[model samples]
Target chain A: MARIDLVDLAHAYRPNPTTDADYALRPMNTSWRQGGAYALLGPSGCGKTTLLNIISGLVVPSRGHVLFDGVDVTRLATEKRNIAQVFQFPVIYDTMTVRENLAFPLRNRGMPAAAVAARVGEIAELLDLNVDLDRRARALTPDAKQKISLGRGLVRSDVAAILFDEPLTVIDPALKWELRSKLKALHRALDLTMIYVTHDQTEALTFADTVVVMHDGAIVQMGRPNELFERPEHTFVGHFIGSPGMNVLPAKVEGRTADVGGVPIALGRSYSAIPPGRKIEIGIRPEYVRLSSGEGVPVRVERIDDLGRIRFAKVRLGDARLSVVAPPGVRLEDDRSRVSFDPAQIHVYADSRRIEGDA
Target chain B: MDKPINNAAWFLILPAFAIVLFNAVIPMMTVVNYSVQDSFGNNQFFWNGLGWFQELLDPSSELGGRFFASLGRSALFSAIVLAVQVPLGIAVALSMPRSGIALALCLVFIAMPLLIPWNVVGTMWQLYSRSDIGLLGWTVNAIGIPFNYTNSVLAAWTVLVLMDTWHWTGLIALLCYAGLKSIPDAYYQAARIDGASRWAVFTRIELPKLRSVLLIGVLLRFMDSFMIYTEPFVVTGGGPGSVTTFLSIDLVKIALGQFDLGKAGAMSIVYTLIILAVCWVFYTVMVTPENKGARE
Candidate 1:
């Protein structure tokens, strides 16, 4: 395994990109530590796959260097880079048995027959494919085929990293959880630096130690799952991560108070040095915003979603809509209720980017 | 709920059935009628009752000996054509550019020969291989190989095979190209990641993916070449001797040239049955294993 570094890496499918919009992946520098599991999480067309492809050497970046363990491999072919990639769809040699499918990479590298067999046996056992080892790959279900694809990558011990590009896309939903857990177990057992690209937030949060949240061709935040949940560096991350996502509402901030549509809300920290003529907003998680009968900012309850164990109130304060967690014992007599935000959980934003305030 | 039975739906296909009856079934019945009777001129037929079929099947009889010889020749020609065309077509397909203006140009060029009329192809090759005025025969003879298709059986066979290859290898190549196109880019990317060699990629991935399309190409080429008559008849006239007299040519010579309707009809039935049997066997052998695996 090797540490992969992207030094000012950027890519554009077009000839010469002049604007940020022209680039598929914006210029950025980041390092993935060896033996760490990282997930590149974003929505469709968010350049997560582009970044993963760049790391795998499938697409050469329009600018910048890819350094694997501090050696420049920017122009290297995928085979020479010692990287393995499992694509969105399972790719297997249909004519070959599962044993031969797993053995392919090892044999291609000229590994001895005994060693190939041993490695194949190990991988088949690890993937629970030992029983179907002699069966042709064409006859297997999609999940089994995907397991063989993963086993092919795992059988080779010298791979620098294993990249997964939404590899569970074609799997049945019931099997997605099982295969996902199996992958996490594989990462722990093999200790290989794995980069998984996915659009699903749950998959990313569950699989990676560090999740890199991307939006509009740029990485918005790179942190642990909880770090992303608690503090989003950019407004996009705040709006993209959580289940209902963090609520971002336009407001006017001055000193230790913010005004949302003429309704004043208290802030825990002061932002006296706020820049002139910029879009100001405040973000808070629905979990931290409690709906109650106590004295707070008055809101009109639009609807209440009863989610089995908990309920969330979709409320409107003046003109701004917000989602607030409704307390289990509290009941709204009418469509009106009071919603309070925990001061510490409130984050201030300027021009769609988070800004620090003096405590 | 009980399902509605729709027996009336069968009437909807009557138009198609009528078309087939007129175009195929009626003509085949006439041939069958001719096969079972002896006919002299004036459309007068007498009951022959398997006399022609029995004679055609007996190798000691004149018609039987001629029929067997021509059948063997046609089968051999088909085998040679398949052996040469399939691999060459695959190679051409593999070498084609994946995309861009060049790919469009290559597709059009490969499709040119297939677009020509069959009789036109026969006539073109007939003139193109003439020793006196043709470029191919004249150039070969100029290069110190005494090649004349009219007089030499080997030369005639070579010309016939080459003409057929030139006229039809494009069909196989185009089919193979289409098959190759249907393969996802992920397979090649995965193969590269696996460090597979070029030959390994072709054999393990491409060839297996191409099996279904190649089956279609083989069957089409086999039936077309097995029933081949026009080009060889145009070029050799089954000549110098009976060297290139394939089944169709021999049958035509009997039915039209000599007007022996009974013998010709029997030969035609046997020839068609042979083709149908071979196709059935080939299709079963190739498709059954994969279908069995699929069912499991």
Candidate 2:
């Protein structure tokens, strides 16, 4: 386990990064504790892979430092950085057998042949790839190839950190949950510092202990998985981290209450540093939005989605529509519907940044 | 069994196949027929069996030794061409930018040699290797090195070798460059993350992927070099004492110049077999399941 420190790292694809827009990765300063499993989650062009590449030393930062175990290694190459990385697709040599593919790095490092073989066998068994020890890598299917890639990255327990950049993207949906669980198990067994970057929020939240949410080249917030979902600090985090994302309704804040679409809702607490007489929005996750009769916004039920475990009643209020999660068998029985939510669960945001909250 | 006769498509292929049969297959068959028989004059012939093959097989006598010497020269020429061109071609391919003005400039330069006719290239080098007027020859002579292809076998071989390299290295480089360009940038990115040394990336990735293209390059170069006649013939004219006379040049000398049709035909069959066999072996080794797409 190693404490990773990234001090003011910024990257730009273009030679001259004149403005903030020119940078693919906005300036970031963050750190991770030893033996922590972390994930950088974002949309496709949100600089998640770029940040991963920068950390793996595949991309050089235009400014600032990256220190692993307090050693300044910003200028060092990937080979000198002492980190293992797995690509989005499997990157094994097609000519070599699975065994040879696993043994290549160890042999290149001048590890003992016996030790190399033993480790290769162990990783092969872990990946359920022992039967393919002598089979050519080219002959394997896409899923098998990805397993080899995952195994290769995890094979070396001696590396300071292991980085993965969307390694499970090529995997099938049915196998994704199983593989993600396996990765979590591997991290627990080895205690290696692992950093995973993915665009899928579910993948990040479920697999990582801490999820770092990035948006438009900047990290909006970083916290534990539950913290990200329960209290998203930024609007982007709220929309990004959950399925049937948190509903953000445009409202005007008046002291401790918000008047949303001619309906009054109490915030139950005052927010400091944010002046009242401005356009403010209230955000609440669907799970926290309690739907009942005649207590909240006057809206018409557009449709109802039955997901078996819970029902999502999509209601249109003024110009915006909000999804409210109801208990199973709850259906929209009326055209004109009234659904309400707890005021404590509501998060206030002025612009895209969250207003100061106790959460 | 009922078979459909598609006469409409047949019309398109009939003319092309007829032309090939007349120009290529018939001539080859005539050679094959001549190889097994004794051709006297005006199509007068007698059966000769394997006597011609027997004569070339034993290299003790003068004709036998000449046959072996020409074969050896052909092999050496091919070896030299492979040695100079494959690495040089790969280096040039690697250096070429994938797109834009730099690639355009590279394309223009690579196309220059390809545009020159084989005989013209030989003639160009022949004049360019003169001790009096040519820059290379004049420089060498002025620097106190006696450089004359008319006399020195080494000088003639050097001139012809350089001419061949100039004629075909561009083709090899272009083929390899196409293959290299087809490789995804992801492979390089993966290599970077894997912390591969430059040589390892090149050896494990680039070179292995280049296998198919390089096979085609080698086969084309080998066939061209083996059957080479025009360029070397025009430059050195088989040299003083036949030092640069390749098998093709020797076959032409026997069949057309000296009118030994039977021997030339036999040697032609042998040459074709050698090329076919070698190329088949190359295709098999490179495109096999274990070795195929090894780089990917």
Question: Against the unseen true structure, what C-alpha lDDT does each candidate score?
Answer: 0.92, 0.84
Q: Per-prediction DockQ, in order?
A: 0.77, 0.31
lDDT of 1 by residue, A22-101 (tens): 99999999999999999999999999888988888888999999999999999999889999999999999988888989
**Which CAPRI quality tier does the interface of model 1 achieve?**
medium
Model 2: runs farther than 4 Å from truth? A271-273, A276-279, A290-295, A306-310, A326-333, A357-359, B1-24, B33-68, B95-104, B189-195, B260-262, B289-296
Q: Per-residue alpha-carbon lDDT of model 1 for B1-296, expressed as tens digits? A: 99999899999999999999999999999999999999999989999999999999998999899998998889889999999999999999999999999999999999999888777887888888889999988999999999898899899999899989998999999999999999999999999999999999999999988999998999999999999988888888898699999999999999999999998888889889999999998898888878876776
Clashing pairs in model 1?
none
Interface RMSD, all models, one decimal each? 1.2, 4.3
Pick the lDDT winner: 1
User: Each model's fnat?
Assistant: 0.79, 0.31
* Model 1 quality (TM-score): 0.97
